[model samples]
Target: MDSLRTCVACRRRAARDELLRVVLSGHRLIPDDRAALPGRGAWVHPTPKCLKQAVSRGVFARALRASGRLDAGPLENRLETLMDN
Candidate 1:
């Protein structure tokens, strides 16, 4: 059976194939589109605006249960690159 995951920002539950997965590597947030990362993941709508909204509203931090501040630059950059491709 396929796994299902929910987007923290959009509050939408979707099949594993439908959402974008992101992970926090130390102080950086990186995209794990293949869903193979072994850590807490934050999901967004695979859109740049949604990514921005999640970061600005602190949803990503809350979802990951991260105590320290998060660096959104890497996340935003990865999202932008994905959007471009």
Candidate 2:
């Protein structure tokens, strides 16, 4: 069976690889561009709108099972870079 995960921002279930992966690392939220990082993870559509929604809704923490605020700046930048490639 195909693996599935839900987008924390859009809250839609899709193929695991179809969504971008984010992982918690040292109290910071890092985007797993290659989805290879370990630890708790969160999923979201690779779009600013979804990222914004996820941030504004404060869902990353819960999804990643993290406490306090998370830094998604790097993730956003990485997304932009990936999109540009």
Candidate 3:
């Protein structure tokens, strides 16, 4: 059976493998596609819709305990590339 994780955007529980893992990287949000990055991480679906909602709702910052605005550009680019792959 697959483990479950809650999406910070939609607030829905889903299989861990089905969700993307995001970690804080010096005030920036970095997508951990491999889920191997260290430190606290936040889970979200790998879709721009979810990402936007998460950002608008401040879920990423709250979940990661970020002290400043999170730069999600890199993470978004990574997710786009991952979706293509």
Candidate 4:
């Protein structure tokens, strides 16, 4: 059986490996590459456009279930780095 997870941005179920896992660490968004981050996790496609949509449209916050500030800088950099790999 394949592991399944929901993409917070798209609100659709996808294979675990098919989506990127994002976590909320207090005031920041962290990419849980190993999916081992403890806490609530959000997910989005491994695309820059999706990242932009999730951040600009407040999808991440909604998925994370918290209302606070968010910083996209490091997350964006991390996504770019992952895309390169």
Candidate 5:
């Protein structure tokens, strides 16, 4: 059975595989496509809407137990690439 994870943006729980995992790397958000990155991770639906909510509401930092601002540009670009494929 798939483990459940809560989306930081939607605040909804779903199967872990159904959401994208994001990890912080030196204040920058990085998409963990393989879910193998070290450190804390924040999950979110792989959609622009969810991404927007996560960024706009500053949920990533809170969810990842990080303080200060986080750059989501890398994550955003990764999501765009994934969506394009």
Candidate 6:
């Protein structure tokens, strides 16, 4: 069976494969497309709406157990590019 995870932005539980995994690298957020990144990771729906809510509401830091704010620009750009393709 597939594992399940909760989306930090929408607060909905979904299958692991249905969501995108995000990890922290220094002070920036990185998208773990393969979910192979080291360190604490947070899951979120791979949607623009979820991404916006996660960033605006500062959910990634909380979910990842990261202190203070984290740079989400890289994640945002990644999502944008995915949407474009």
How accurate locally, in lDDT, is each candidate?
A: 0.80, 0.85, 0.91, 0.83, 0.94, 0.94
Q: Estimated TM-score per prediction?
A: 0.85, 0.88, 0.92, 0.88, 0.95, 0.95
lDDT of 3 by residue, 1-85 (tens): 9989999999999999999999998988999988899999999999888988998888999999887788988888987897798
Q: What total of clashing residue pairs does each candidate reach?
A: 0, 0, 0, 0, 0, 0
> Can you tell me which runs of candidate 1 are displaced by over 4 Å?
none
Model 3 pairs in collision: none
> What pairs collide in candidate 5?
none
Q: Compared with the true structure, what per-residue lDDT tens digits does model 1 show for residues 1-85? A: 7777888777888787777888888877788878899999887778866787787788887888886778888778877787788
- Cα deviation at 23, candidate 2, in Å, is 0.3
Model 5: lowest-lDDT 10 consecutive positions: 33-42
Model 6, position 74: C-alpha lDDT score: 93
Model 6 per-residue lDDT tens digits across residues 1-85: 9999999999999999999999999889999999998888999999999999999999998888899879998999999998999
* Model 5 per-residue lDDT tens digits across residues 1-85: 9999999999999999999999999999999988999988989999999999999999999999999999999999998997899
Q: After superposition, how far is residue 36 of candidate 5 from its true place, in Å?
A: 0.8
lDDT of 4 by residue, 1-85 (tens): 7788877666778898888888887768888888898998887887887788899898888888978778767788898898899
- Model 2, which residues run further than 4 Å from truth? none
Backbone clash total, candidate 4: 0
The window of 10 residues in a row where model 2 has the poorest summed lDDT is 25-34
Q: Quote the RMSD, in angstroms, for model 3.
A: 1.1
Candidate 6: regions farther than 4 A off: none
Candidates 2 and 5 compared by lDDT, better number = 5
At residue 82, candidate 6 shows an lDDT of 89
Query: Which candidate do you rate higher for lDDT, 2 or 6?
Result: 6
